[model samples]
Target: MGLFDSFSQIRNILKNIDLAAVHKLSQKVDLNKLMGTVSKMSEEDLAKMLKFMQAGSGDKRPKPEVNGDFYDLSKTLSAEEKAIQLKVREFMETEIKPIANEYWNKAHFPMHIIPLMAKLDICGLTYKGYGCAGKSSLLEGFIAMEMARIDSSISTFFGVHSGLAMGSIYLCGSEEQKQYWLPIMQRMEVIGAFGLTEPEVGSAAAGGLTTTCRKEGDEWVLNGQKKWIGNATFSDITIIWARNPEDNQVKGFIVRKDNPGFKAEKMEDKMALRTVQNALITLTDCRVSEVDRLQNANSFKDTANVLRMTRAGVAWQAVGCGRGAYELALKYTMKRKQFGRPIASFQLVQDLLVTMLGDLTAMQTMVHRLSQLQDGGDITDEHASLAKVFCTLRMRSIVDHARELFGGNGILLEYDIARFVADAEAIYSYEGTKEINSLIVGRAITGESAFV
Candidate 1:
């Protein structure tokens, strides 16, 4: 071939090769000498070289599926349970995921989606009667995971309604109260909130609730403030826990939203879980009928029963948050190119991904066993507390690593990883902080009370 004709053919061949590969090749070989060698090559040899270059120019293997469930724990669920899990997942992806960042950014609750969520018929999932599904706690845990996987704030709303509010009525209310409230709540017609944490009391709520309750004739008066009450701003009814001074024992009262003396001001400017409408509740001489009083909840121990059950669900939520962040980071790394290749191809990136997966997998399996214990009716305060402590702590780490993987974009809310990072902070602190939960487990193992 003529030298000009050969150079023309080589230019065409080089155009098809990856730029990064060509750049590397140029760094190693003398371009002038390579051209001289190529100019003398036969047409058949040139074609073979083109084929070899094309073959080695870029990755050709099919990419691995981005799944955080490395152990496939969902397979252990029954077919029916799996269906419910997938249904919730689909709902979150379709309805919640698109608006998650938007709503989270605005720090506003998506009130319009509540009706859509109600249609799932998952409210009061584990309760046996009063319009509940009577499903296993394992199924309930999966549902929580699915919801939080897409958005943690929505999960918190649902947990407050179904797990805490309805749970109080189911566990501590009179038979009449359960029969009356659970059906409407199950239908999502009457939203509920749990009011336990006070402005001055959170971890010390068991023994130091300053909110006072007094019984007078047929009306019981509740006078106290509750802080950080999720769903309180819009909840139809709130289960208010207050100290009855006469007995010095904590008691629960179902306070209606329209009561003249009850006011719930939305707590604003939160850095985490912004979509949740947490409230600073003020109960100035709020009078409830004797019938509204929780007949079975005579003391804080009854309240703790509700907390023990809900805390296990919180652990599952941490798994969901971590799972979401890990999955997002994994997908981002595969698409985000560095040095003309997917960052996922690099050793350090893979190492970080594996570390996140390890923490996520461990969190999932721990919550899986936690739900099993709950299903078998063998759950304890320490059991739930231990899961909550470990899972939330690991969730914090996973989100941190995920944010790190995104570099500067991690802090920008548009990337969604930023939301996971901020939300993880709230989960780490709420539903009983790590210190309190650890002490619970510590007390269990050592048989020694650490609270002074």
Candidate 2:
């Protein structure tokens, strides 16, 4: 064969080799000596070498993004609600997004963010009085969704304070109690926690009140343990639900942190929603004045009323989580290239993205109606429970599909889906488990309570 033909054959062979390996090879080879040798070659030989280098280079092209909420649910809200939603989104993206993983990893709550979050003026968003905004329940649900989309732990923190704890007082507290606590709590100057679940009891908190309270002169003595109490560790006050010994009826008390017998210890090493400051609270001879007891909370039925409202918020939170996962996965798929094209363009990948969006949209719509029911004063426990059960179940499925789209990167915290995947577990269990909430609906339809 001719020498020129031999050189062309060699260049064709080198083009199949990896450019990264070739660069490494070039580094070891004396570039001056190599250049001296290659400079003697014809221009055609250099062109072939350049072509080989270009062909051997690995792809570094950008991928497309995958976003859920294709229907633009935000547009369904009023212009005012939409603006507030955007503000919340911006806050989550800017403030919470950066530190979420870190706090989650360490299982620590970011107390400093509480003051800043309160400044957003979103607490008691749906309540009509007691220094509240009196916004629509839809707006409140959307705000919960926005917070949870970025970090469910933070959302839980807010929900416990704004929804469960403060809501309990708003819905059941007397006018005097409202005047005393609502304004400070609205400003987040006094953080609140809800103590409902116990170490041995969770979903059965209703009709299974192990915590006991007794009247002693003008004060109520409380004794029991509460587990998984979010925001309890540093909360200014915790709403402790206990059974009144005299009447055997469930009652609510505003247990201040400095109360001599109120002890709250931080629960450690949680795998999901770790950024929330969960506490295992021990109330031994805790003294709460009769005036601090929620006057309107006559029974466990009243407590369920609070859960009904917060459960709807949980449904919205689930939608936010699914939306976040879908959006992140879709974005990753579009940008991550394989086989010389974006993965998002692949059929199977598109299938997953579409499925996630469908679930997200379903969840969003379901919660929208739920909020409407709440606003119209026709919301039932079954309504909120059904939404909670349905949305959270779908959310788990959506996050799993989203993680699948990320391939190896799906498991990494930096990708964002990992947090959603983890947070979904807590969302699934808290407020009410799938079984508990399902039975709440089951009791409504079948007229039978299956909960043992």
Highest lDDT scorer: 1
Model 1: runs farther than 4 Å from truth? 1-59
- Residue 309 in candidate 1, Cα distance off native in Å: 0.2
Put down candidate 2 lDDT per residue, 243-306, tens digits, no spaces. Answer: 9878889999999999999999999888898888889999999999999999999899889889
Candidate 1 lDDT over 1-452, as tens digits, reads 55466566557667877789778989999988987887688887876775675466542558889998899999999999999999999999999999999999898999999999999999999999999999999999999999888899999999999999999999999999999999999999999999999988999998999999998999988898999999999999999999999999999999999987999999999989999999999999999999999999999999999999999999999999999999999999999998998899899999999999999999999999999999899999999999999999999999999999999989898889999999999999888999999999999899998986
Candidate 2, position 215, lDDT: 93
lDDT of 2: 0.87
Q: Positional deviation of 81 in candidate 1, in angstroms? A: 0.9
List, in order, the clash count of every candidate structure.
0, 8
| lDDT of the candidates, in the order given | 0.93, 0.87
TM-score of each: 0.89, 0.85
